[model samples]
Target: MTTSTSSKGSLQLFPFLDLKAQYRTIKPEIDAAIQRVMESQQYILGPEVESLEKEIAAYTQAQFAIGCASGSDALLLALMALEVGPGDEVVTTPFTFVASAGAIARLGARPVFVDIDPITYSLDPGKLETALTPTTKAIIPVHLFGMAVDMDSIMEIANTREIPVIEDAAQAIGAKYNGRAVGGIGLCGCFSFFPSKNLGAAGDGGLLTTNDPEFADNLRVLHNHGGHSKYECEVIGMNSRLDALQAAILRVKLRYLDAWTEGRQKNATRYSELFKSRGLDRILGLPRVQTGCTHIYNQYVIRAPQRDELKAALRGCGVPTEIYYPVPLHLQRGFSYLGYKPGDLREAEAVSREVLALPIFPEMSAGQQDLVVNAIATFYGTRAFAP
Candidate 1:
């Protein structure tokens, strides 16, 4: 929602997410791609979408890929392929975007909420086995904030139970776990091309990757009204297809994704150095990357006491910050039918209250980073925001 451009005067203003500056850097390529799609009059899925599907499949090392309307739809299609329905349960963390749980509920299945690991902010594998039952249909592990989930522990637990894993890797396009891409490690990987993601398209787009041809075929049919050929009805499905223009534009941006990701990583390191030098590190809980996980830093979230007050102070100081989710999904009013109550999952509820994301876009300059650090320092005053 923050469409504000990068600041040019005195490094005073910072947008929570600066998509415009990113657009400026690749305007020519983006424009040409869009124009080509327009000239061809191919706005729906066609050669462009097919090409992107191949490129993404190769990028993630998956045997098959299919594009869809949005990340939320990708989750829905994956669930449909597995035939998840009433009397079944899908296990996932309670701290992720609503789409993770929403997809399960939409299919008339129950969503089982599990607590998250405090360090990784992902599903806690130690507690995973306790949530499974005979009717457990699948497990959806989210790669939150561009950090790879502890997939080894999760997969080991899941495989023993004979439960399939659908990875929500929307925030982690290029992130890796133990040298393997996040998408390729699961049964089917779901990715989002929302404008703010690391490898975002010009608009909404999504892709699914899987090694099973049957699963890929099911997903493709489900996304296109349950039939590969028009005017022929197979099974009940939804109307959700990726746009050709979006795929063309994504192809262009995909070329420079690694460089942009490096910029974000370097920026994260600079923030750490600044925080340590200013002793802010003692007061704030910076992100911790696990040994086998390669974090792409889609978001630079930090923990602090009185997070609300700190956010207000940062805004007053001309620094923009965002709370990834001020309220966890289980506690949401819309999901009260799920019968979850306060204190059910302590870590997720606790994290919802303390986490705040700062601007870590590739184009953010060192001066802008300095301004952010200085504002936090000024807010804490002499106590320096002690935890």
Candidate 2:
């Protein structure tokens, strides 16, 4: 076994993500796609963007996929399509990125806070019912860190209340719940191509997937300034169309999305085995992939007692790590108008202090992984344990 000290000065530092490695591998195909877009000279909503939207829809098994400017815009557009505005309350988890809640608030809708599942780190389905009132119009269950939320339970709840579900699939592109693709299960699934997601573009991009034709048409108009045709404004809509350049790049990357997802799954398995063998299982809680759900492992996050100290030790040993969300959405200053207290969400508050994401990108090597795992083990070994 290679010790962390042996390669202390010689080891290359691992990054939390390795997009450049992926780019280098598919550079030829990517370059050709860009060249095609340039030669066509149709820079805006052209054939490239249209084709990518169709491809994404086909992949997710949705009737339509509307490309947009960013993931936040995708969520905002979904709410607009549903006509969510002031006096409406959208139930969602406080443990995810701020955009999950911010989108609703942008539409003048209130985002009612809900806690998360301790193991899956998704919106707690049980708490959702209590958060619901007559003002509740929808539930936005975010597939946090590439793991699908408990959609079966969420769907049942939504069906009972006659509310729609807008899936925040920004982190989970190929992830599935009960063999159904994430984006297709909900009323509308929102995806992001923010250069770091599982199916990322060269820059910022987003796509909205839906099975309802009318909802799909509404989204198209919402993304294109509330008009079906250019310069034909109907409703008060904003401009959030996807650029042809990013669409071209995304089309190239989509071909290899399945292969990349497989690699992430394999890496996650390796981390499980390595962590278990090192006897860190007792100290750290590994992520759990629910049965019948296929997790793409966008960020192989773990929960540990000394989460901050572990991150510092990993950095010292040339291993990279990240904290997905140090502050829960309800606790964030941006939503202070909601007037939430610290103990309001016990699970979200507890996990916010413990969750740490390890580098689990497709291009990550076993040697690099060993460095991260060994550093974690060393950190635990040196610290005092509680009885």
Candidate 3:
């Protein structure tokens, strides 16, 4: 199936993500699942939703899974369950999506920003110590770009300080750290099924996982207007329930997640090999997967000195590339009151400028991969002497 092209005249050879391709592969099953939900006419919490929660919990080895409206809501609900509110501070990285910090600010809690590790592009656990204070109530470690953060160190620090660790597994559903699942290792693991994630739904969906029964119960109430029974309000809450249709769709997609994850890993290996063969290491820093961690390659980002120019060159050659984030969360205009200035987090600031995400989906073809590699090589070869 050919993808519809935009007026930009570029081939549309690569999309940031190819959800359509995945849908085509599982059309029959997905259609059947949707039909089942439609026939049941149970639009809200039902058997499908309950089954999905149980399945996801079993898959992640967690005791419970609470589905929510979106990943941001999942984070917010987790914070609410932990009783994180005004005067509390949540320590987290300054490099992830705005929602990471936004979740904290929503509860009137200050988000203490920490620098990232240049190699991992994850919250630097080593730098976390200095950021802790008397008001620190929780630590949110985001598994940025499908790579797991050093959970052992983060958990150790959290345990020492008696602070809860919330794993922002939005980009890392199946990703593992030291043989443990990303979300299952923390106090509450938050996942996003925003179509672009490793295991995505047709639309916005999220789940919070935990082994603690009380935490799970709290999250359920937190997502459903703080009620146990209909119209019986328990605690102050917000509307964030995951619909049944999305739950059914997710169940079908979940079956294919592991195989898709393997494909992504294989594509990443191919990209690395191609770059190494052309001696591009001198000009680009390839992604590195730490020992014992399984990188799902949600975004095979590379650090290139002239990232923007390289991206433009790729566009000129029918290759698609994207900047994961051009600005760090701490430096964004919305958080100016945090008083973070330039050089506050040197690593995150530097990476924000240099990091570029190439076309990397599970269904990427080898020929497409070759085209992307050749485009980069040609760009570097031509521009090496321009300046």
What lDDT score is found at residue 344 in candidate 1?
98
What are the lDDT scores of the predictions, listed in order?
0.90, 0.90, 0.90
Q: Model 2, clash count?
A: 0
Error at 62, model 1, angstroms = 1.3
Q: Alpha-carbon error at 323 in model 2, in Å?
A: 0.2
Which lDDT value does model 3 have at 256? 95
How many backbone overlaps does candidate 1 show? Answer: 0
Error of 2 at 264 (Å): 0.7
Regions more than 4 Å wrong, model 1: 1-12, 382-387
lDDT of 1: 0.90
Per-candidate alpha-carbon RMSD to the true structure: 3.4, 4.0, 2.8
Instruction: Find the candidate with the highest TM-score and give its number.
Output: 3
How many Å off is the CA of 67 in candidate 3?
A: 0.3
The TM-score measured for candidate 3 stands at 0.96
